[model samples]
Every structure is written in C-alpha cells, then in structure tokens.
Target: MEIFMKVFTKKLFAGAALSIAAMSSAPSFAGENPTSPIMGIPASSLEEFGGREGVRAWVESLFYYIMLDNRIAPIFREFGNPERQIFLNTQLETMVLGGPNEYQGASMSAAHADLGITMTQFNAVVEAAYNACERNVIKYHTCNQLINALAPFTADIVTR
Candidate 1:
C-alpha cells in the first residue's frame, strides 16, 4: 500500500502540473461557485440525458467505472452505500442542467477536503463520467456540455 501510494502521489502531482500548463490559456473560472448550476444550457439538454432517471443510471455507470479503475478505486472505498452516492450525483447532474436543485450534499471542497484528492484522480473520474454518458447514449455535444459545466469544480475538488 505504501509503495502504491507513493507511485500514485508522484503521478498525481505530475498530472496536476501538466493539466495546469495545458489549461493556462483557458478562461478564468474565478468567482464561479463550484456547486452552482450552470445557466444557459439548452432546455432540451436534460432530455438528452433522459431526465432524472437516466441521469441516475449514468451515475451508476460512472461509479462502476470508478470501481473498476485501480488508480482511484481505493479512494472511493472510504465511502459507503454506492446507491446513495449515485442518487446524490444524479441530483447534482440534474441541477447542473439548470433543473431544480435537489442535491442534498456538501460543497465539493468540504466534501473532499480530507481525501487528499489529486488531479490524476479527478481527470480519471471525468473520463469515467464521459464514458458513462456515452454508454447511456447521450448525444456527444450534450456530454461535452455536462463535462464543461463540471470542469470548473476541479479547483474545489482537488486538495493536492
């Protein structure tokens, strides 16, 4: 476990540095609330994700991917009741679609502060989410939109 964590930590910082360099030209997300809904998404966007039920299904798939990923699966083992987490994620995703905010969860930073989450894990989770959206047959554009809305939360999620 110690060896694995050491290797993981090394990769984590390296990936974080690379990501910072790559996103240097990206527009500032300053002043954006990580938990706030993204405004201006097309009304039909929620339909593309097949509404709340479909979003829940996608979140389930996302968890499956997370569990299958060795690089970050251990982090999630610290939590319990995957179903509850999926439900919360579904609500969060629904909220991100400019829908009703039913997400009864802590803020991203507070929720993850003690986890020592890293950019490598964050990116891995993002890729898993994208794959989940694809598997659910959500349109390509809508998947990108979902990811874009969630991307800015990296600042709140990654605790080093």
Candidate 2:
C-alpha cells in the first residue's frame, strides 16, 4: 500500500509541474508582439501619455523653453519665420504622436552647421525636451523611447 501511494504521489507532482510549465509558456491573449518597433505597446497606450492633448502640450512647452529660455531663442528670433515655426511645431507634434505626418525639417547637421551649437547647448536642449515631456505627464519609458528614436537626428542638427 505504501509503495502504491508513493508512486501515485510522484505522478501527481509530475503532472502538476507540467501544468504549471505549460501555463507559463502559453501565449497570452493580450496579442502582444515583443519584437515590434513600438515595443509591443499598443496605440491605446497613448492615453497614458495624455493622448493628443498631452502631445500638443509637450511640444508647446518644448518650443517655449527652446525659444525663450535657451540661447537658441535668439538664433530663432533672428532667422525663424513665424509661419515656419508654426508649421514646424505642427509637424513635430504629429511625428511625436505617431500621427500621419512626415517631418521635413532640414537635416539636423545642416540646420545647425552655421550656428556653431556647442555640446553644452545640445545637452541643455535635450534635457529641456525631456522635461517638457515629463511636465505633460508622458510615460517615462515612452518618452525615452521617443527621444531615442529622434536622437539620430542630432547628427544632422548639431554641429561645431
């Protein structure tokens, strides 16, 4: 009787272990694709970043800081046409929000080539941009991801 009980217990434990393993390895119903460009984050997730309103607010704040609080403001004030600024802002907002718009701004390097932007100023702008995103309650990782995506443009925008 003892031998029979021992075998039964072992089989029960093995079955339970297999069940747990299967559960762990099972596909989730959430339809997540871990390798996607959006990191499996759904568009609905934008709600957490304040949706369209949040995106607009963030872009406005970023422009305000860059155009007012930073030395770059003077450069823009000297050469930036108001209409161009408005168009750029719109394009930036659309791009940032994953909307259907393409940013056709001058390549970053060419844009800044004549201005002689320093590393310090570039860093400051980057910091200000992130701060603007945070002020609008954008998710940290999402904001970071967006920043990372846009970062390659620095090569085009930043220069000696």
Candidate 3:
C-alpha cells in the first residue's frame, strides 16, 4: 500500500505539472470561459449528450470503465452503492447541462482536497467519459466539447 501510494504521488505531481504546462502553453481565448476551437464547428452542448437519461447511462458506463482501470479503480472501490452512484450521475449530468445547479454536493476543490487525485486519474476519468459517450452514440466532437468545457476545473480537482 505504501509503495502504491508513493507511485501514485509521483504520477500525481508529474501529471499535474504537465497538464498545467500544456494549458499554459495553449493559445487561450480572451474570456472567462473559453471553448475549444474545433475547425470552426460550434461548441456542442449538454443536450448533445442525449439529455438527462443519456447522461445517466453514460455515467453508469463511465463507472464501469473506472472500475476496470487499475490506475484509478482503487479510489472508487469503497464508494460503491446503487443509490450513491445514481445520485452522483444525476448531479454530474445536471451540472453539465447548465441547468439549475441542483447539485448541492461538495465543491470540486474541497471534495478532492484530501484525495491526492492526480492528472493521470483525472484524465483517465475523462477518457472513460468519452468512451461512455461513444457507447451512447454521442458524436465524438460533442463529447469533447463537454470535456473542453469542464477542463477549466482541473486546477480545482488536482490536489496532490
């Protein structure tokens, strides 16, 4: 357990540093919220994620990926329960939709502050989410748009 924690810590710092560098180097837009430019295509919305029901399904699929991923599976292994997963899925989807932030859950920074979450784990979750989108028949770019929108929260999430 100690060895694994050490490895996770190494990957965490390295991943966070790299992500910060990459974000800093990228040509950012001049606004509070910037969308990724994908060859002039309009940024996709949460609607493109098949709405709430689809989001729920996607979350389920994503958790499956998370469970299988050795890099981050340990983090979620103890947080299992159907109701908890469903509630999490609902909150995430609601937030993604720009709807009433009915999500009274913990803030990103606070939620992950003590978790030692790394970029590798974070990106793994993103990839899993994208995979879930594909499985749900959501267009790839649309899925990426959601990721792009949520990318800014990376700083709040990585706390190692």
Candidate 4:
C-alpha cells in the first residue's frame, strides 16, 4: 500500500499545482462594458431569435435537455422548484434578447453557492446554454455577448 499511497500523493500535488497555475494564468475579470454588442443589442433585433415565442421555445428545449441529460440535471435538481426554474429561464432569455424585463433573480453565485459546484459542472451548464442558443439560430456573436454579460456572476456560483 505504500507504493499506492506515494502515487496518490504525487497525483494530488500535481493536480493542486496545475490548478494554481491555471488560476494565475486566467484573465482578470472586469465588468462587461455597456457599449459591447452584447449589452447593445436592441430588443427589436430579437425577432431573429423568433422573438418572445422563439425565446420561450428555446428555453423549454434547453430545460428539457438539462432535465434529461445526466451530466447537468442533478445540479439543477439540487435547487428544485420547477415553476421558479421556468421563471428564471424566461428571465435569462429576456435579458439576453434585450427585452424590457430585467432579471430579478439572485446573482448566479448566490443562487448556486450552496451546491458545491465544480468547474466541470459549470462548463457543462455553459455548453447546454450555448446549445440552446444555437438551436434557435441566434447569432454566434450574440450568444458570446450574452455569455460575456453573464460571466461576471461566476464569482458567486462557483463554490469550489
């Protein structure tokens, strides 16, 4: 068992070192500029995304995927409340599409802080969110803009 223990110790230390290096190399987070295309998108332009109906459809598809997909559903399940989930999803769609409605939900970090979420889970959620956007043919630049707009909230969401 001594050999096994040594291997595990080395692996653990290597992982920790790599994590620190990655953190040090990451770009500094500043707030999103209001002038960026993401924030600048007019509510009228959202018609390309099928407007309110289209946004709602995409959100439903995304949530269905999140519910059925083993990798992502559990994290959402931990938070529970189907009705509230729908509301939150609608708010996200509206916010991204430049609708007049503002998102009144808690910050992403605050909403997710108790879940002990890992980096992998966060990435999975982002991928799912992107897929939802793509399914509706929302422009890539717009999708990226939305992600950038929402990225700053990670500070509250990541518990680990």
lDDT string, candidate 4, 11-30, tens digits: 44434433223222322233
Cα lDDT for residue 43, model 3?
32
Clashing pairs in 4: 109-156, 109-157
What tens-digit string does per-residue lDDT give for candidate 2 at 50-69? 65556666767776777765
> What is the lDDT, from 0 to 100, of the residue 72 in candidate 4?
68
Clashes of each: 0, 4, 0, 2
Which candidate's lDDT is highest?
A: 1
How many Å off is the CA of 96 in candidate 2?
Answer: 4.7
Better of 2 and 4 by TM-score: 4
RMSD (Å) per prediction? 9.1, 19.1, 9.0, 11.2
Candidate 1 worst ten-residue window by lDDT: 19-28
The Cα local distance difference test for each model comes to 0.69, 0.53, 0.60, 0.57
lDDT of 2: 0.53
User: Could you tell me the TM-score of candidate 3?
Assistant: 0.66
Q: Could you tell me the TM-score of candidate 2?
A: 0.60
Q: Give lDDT for model 4.
A: 0.57
**Better lDDT candidate (1, 2):** 1
Model 1 Cα displacement at 138 (Å)?
Answer: 1.1
Error of 1 at 75 (Å): 0.6
Structural similarity to truth (TM-score) of each candidate: 0.74, 0.60, 0.66, 0.65
